[model samples]
Target: MSDVGDRNGGNDLVRFEGVTKRFDVAKPALDAITGAVRGGEITGLVGPDGAGKTTLIRLMTGLMLPESGTVQVLGFDTRKDPAAIQAGIGYMPQRFGLYEDLSVQENLDLYADLRGLPRHERAATFDELLAFTDLKRFTSRLAGKLSGGMKQKLGLACALLKKPKLLLLDEPGVGVDPISRRDLWKMVENLTEEGIGVVWSTAYLEEAEACDRVFLLSEGKLLFSGEPKDLTARAAGRVFRVSGIPGRRRQMLTKLLDEDGVVDGVIQGDAIRLVTVKDRETRFSAAGDAEVTAAEPRFEDAFIDMLGGGPGGRSRLAETQRSFTVEGEKPVIEARALTKRFGDFTAADNITFDIPRGQIFGLLGPNGAGKSTTFKMLCGLLKPTNGEGRIAGFDLRRDTAEARNRLGYMAQKFSLYGDLSVSQNLQFFAGVYGLHGAHKRERVDLMTSIFDFRSRQSMSAKVLPLGLKQRLALACAVMHEPEVLFLDEPTSGVDPITRREFWTHINGLVEKGVTVLVTTHFMDEAEYCDRISLIYRGRSIALGSPDELKARVANAENPDPTMEDAFIALIQASEEERMAA
Candidate 1:
């Protein structure tokens, strides 16, 4: 039995043979899974939330046992020598714990002691980790005060305290700023080069693309496993971009989806992106107003195609004929010198910005740069210490209630009631938005149909998949169909397919004159915004369209820069300016 687990002894770091796990009255979390995680390479377990990603990780770490078959870690049976396996592996769970009360150095010291490292080795390890994580200057700062990205780095440093053979990261980039995410990935790659085995589990397919090998999972079953390019080849020559969509985008989208061989279609900018069945032959014309051209298939395009295509009939949540009515010529949202202070510590400093009606405006910044503070002030959730803002011509300070009524808000955290069923949550939100009688019924029906929540509406919102929960939150927020919507990090942790669909719906709303003020850590998603305000140290440093901002930071070395490159350059420039001042 022991040697049976050693089937791939040469390179396999972890192995599972027909392993299965199930919770009471639930489907198997890992259904007879068989796989090998190789040494000295990053193996990405890519799947949507509730697809048993964490369960598989736990099984490998000996944190959980399979009902049948075997799990081997470092040549040890997880069911027998669990502690020995744990001692030799560094597993960073989805929630990496950091002592909030401890200072940066103190936290490192604590982890060092917990890992039982030699006293002589502690100092050198701490120094190396601190320099690598870029936390040398923040040694005296409390962990509680660190930004989300900083905390993630600190967690990683602690995880590396003992230099274990394998490092497991579960969704490390969730809610993290783009730069920090890139830095973290670089660190992971560096570790791989050192002959360390790394297993990364993520819902974001982009992150999976970085791994040497990927195992795509769905409902606890392995769908595809091999090189990333092998997966990309699944939908090759079937992806396309249709631009010059003149008008009636909703109709055009629906028309494309309904067309034969068209598996999925989404509105992107003034174009509609569509995916067709690779072998199916069909040419589509959206009212003869759009031009279609074949585009290269990305990893996500293949993933969606593998999933039997996108949600066809129930792809939207907003009403078909919905149109937001702008109140006056002035922008729907205006913030003049908006400032918020926690005592002498300025959370948001004198931030001034204007949001025009019917535009998808983005508020982007590093974590702890006070993007949330600015959102709260603008949404009437927090009072500005000095400056004032107005929503739909209503003063945020004076007419807070009326201002809130004119806009929809989906918080960064999924803030809906956990124990409530999906239908109940939607119904409650409709009532909160003043829907009643037939109006409430009509809106509830639309929410159920658009988000495809009808089948599982009776299930608790807590139990739904992360993507479905996000859909529910968006549905609840827009049940009233307000003139403006404010979303903070709305697409964080969402899968690429769902994120694309979500943005497609947002684009449709913007076309109908519904203004949106949103924030996201995904730079590619930032490209969808009409204009963006780049915040740093609570100040609006740069504000422009994605292209304009990209051009602002472009150099001879980087002629055609991405939004991420532009963002990093601008933020670095801002830091330099602050230091010189």
Candidate 2:
């Protein structure tokens, strides 16, 4: 569009002139890309994983040279004067280097010294940074002890110590909770207001809405670039909200997905957000009684539509899999008064919840709020200082081994053997679960086909892409066909389409009597859960269905709240009540 083109040697804060970069024999990471960022505005680079977002940020920071074209930063040629370019820019990588042994103030002083700030100037700069980041109270605490959100804020403070002319942040909030993400964005907005240019990259489409200009990149190509509102206009009159019977949601979703003109369907708070191929009236017959209504298009809807629906992949669930019904009135999993402590500090305090058979349960909270502590206690990996838990009717404390036999756990980091072949890892996990001989062969073959990894079975797991890695991890976890599944941050770094595919498999398992307990930073994914428990500072703050949680936060101003809004509102309200107490 008119928003992006040849700058013609203009003096923009940063400019990419047909820049191209490659690694070894692979296709160019950035292929003839050109863009400009002004001094007092925010520019967002939005794309999927491996879309060269990180590479582009590296080029701008003078970490790597463009092979053919030029990249200018603050009027200095990146190739000829890399140091000069780096001097005027601040860069925050996805994984920044912070000394765990150093205190917060020590880290800040080190960065200031490296940047050569005078002692007189250092006092005011440090004061401003510590105040802005809300880290003044924790200045003497070790950086390693800070929460994820505080760590990010500390990095931002250090990057700004030199009064950077331009700032580059690469996926700063990828795994951060919604509240931390909001704080980071608010700080970025403040930076832009002070006349510092910013070029940020993110896989989250919702974040793109905050940028003044956004560039949508896929497979190293710029598909669309313009104002956020202008890009969303492309999908006007093309989105709808579908409502159906509560228990029949699974069946309704399948039918809509199979419809001809349907682009995609995802579960919102209490409805299915449906999108069509184009801006026209199309037909969608609900398999049951469901109502459809025209709705406003979100930035996510437009991005998905503009990218041609989604990442098409085949569903490979077993055709002969039988329908599963709950066999009893009692819940399949339960945790009673669970509490975990480290010495004198309580990480998880008196937490309790239950999940019925064939239901999806979500545990949501901010970083360092004891989600992992609770997860570990329920999974029987760690001993609870007090209380007890049960899985598949087996006691977590008295019969840990028996309880473990009927459950599967997938860690947040996808603990796969990177050096081994896909089939090898599957075989190893199968052996661990006591599958042998014909049964082992059958299970391996079935999992291989179900995840559509048969063709790449011999490939090393490390060589596979992020999406494939995620699929393989999930497949390996479910190899035992356990009655309960535990997924922690299951969709963290992957893109939206892959996330949808992953959830589809989980949904099918729910139909097969498998109970799931999941945690996620993405609030949209929380909508898929039958019920959710909001956790904060080692306690359960609220528990309800997705619609119930949203209703609790809804009012005249935002009567129909998105999951993010509901989460923030509830969290803020909880904080207020605690302070009042």
Candidate 3:
């Protein structure tokens, strides 16, 4: 056969030709994929859920083989030289690959030993890796004791221990704070200086901008591949923003989309941005005029447009309704001076907040912030060391079951059974939530259709990609459509396209007047919440609307300001003020 098993000659570190991976009788997970990753540059593979991002990485890492076609890594046939490729490439999965019970230094030592490094060189290698990851001080701490960001950094450090020529990082910044993400990128840049090639897959399009080249995939096929600048150039003159009352934005967008020449429109809070491929047509109205203006198309806007159009139908209608609040409604959740301590550590110290009925209140902060502790207290999963809290007006300490019953909670990890198929997992969750008969079946069907779970319903939970796993978790949590929803890092590791879709579903739930309490590290997502409490070091340092907080931080005499910068500045200011006190 024409040396099909032979390696290709090039500066390319990895290559795939007509690669296809079939898990079942249906369409393959990776369909005839063809691509290459060159040395000394960063390549990003961008896609939504079920786009085969993980499958592609697995093939390259030699963890999985293609049913057809060939995969080449570092000038070796992946199939014939799978062991060699595995030895030469560093792969970090979405999940932390470290042994949780091991200490930071021990984890690094294990990885170094597993990679077959000489015992004499391990000490120097470990020290260098720890310095690069900035985990030198925490060497003796248990791996599980580290925060999410620290764990990710340690995982990366372990992956880089052997000095592999190629690195495969899958969603390394999923739940990491913006500052930590910035630091992680710096580490990647340092790796590039050593002439190491990187193939990184991420859900965040904004992060993709840092890559030398981008590969956009959809449903197991490559849609576009080139520089981030090229993608933005193609979207020029097509994007415009419309700001007004929030309630009317969706209606205006739908009306505009129905009109001739309007390509696509997106509802961004109080504004609707329209993307048009053709020349602009202005339909001026005294009430609300359609303005043709120029603005940059975000990767999210482009991804949604590329997937056909933004969400529509009953979901769109639900987004327009602001009737989540009842007349003279009482707060669904209330916290009073909640405090939690672990030995000398104050996890949540005197935290307090009130979530009004039908409102979505975001709990936001960086890793090591008390957001998770506060969330646990609210859900009755953890009892506060002092003070009190109530959920659905039920005392968290007294009426725990009553409070839990009225709420739907989704944790950061996939909390479903991996062996079970999608439908089964949903049914299992429904049962656990005490649903029965037609009530359960009807709600299950509704969730499946609403979240587009029907196509993947037969697939096992283990087989679904990160995005689908997130969707399933959301669907299960909302099966009964509880009055209050608790989403903890709901879109942490999901791709940009899936994140937008998840938000569309959340907006629909909010229309039904469901109260939402969410904790997230994604600042961009914080903008969607009605109000936010920014917690850090076991306390709430700032609580207000996102814009209000931004304005306050901006007016603080900072040199340059943006929301991201403002958050960093405000947090640093808070720490300084506390120190002074």
lDDT of 1 by residue, 471-539 (tens): 999999889988899998888888766786787678668766788999999887787787889999989
CA-lDDT, candidates in order? 0.84, 0.84, 0.79
- TM-score per prediction, in order, is 0.89, 0.93, 0.89
> What's model 1's lDDT at 252?
79
lDDT for model 2, on a 0 to 1 scale? 0.84
Q: Assess candidate 1 and give its TM-score to the true structure.
A: 0.89
**Compared with the true structure, what per-residue lDDT tens digits does model 3 show for residues 400-495?**
999999888999778889999999999999999999999888778877876688888899998887778888888888776688899999988776
RMSD of 2: 3.1
Cα lDDT tens digits, model 2, 496-534, are 877888887887778777889999999889999989998
Candidate 2's clash total is: 0
- What overall lDDT, based on C-alpha atoms, would model 3 receive against the true structure? 0.79
Evaluation by lDDT, superior candidate among 2 and 3: 2
Error of 1 at 244 (Å): 4.6
* Global lDDT of model 1: 0.84
Model 2: residues with Cα > 4 Å off, grouped in runs: 1-11, 24-26, 311-314, 318-324, 327-329, 452-464
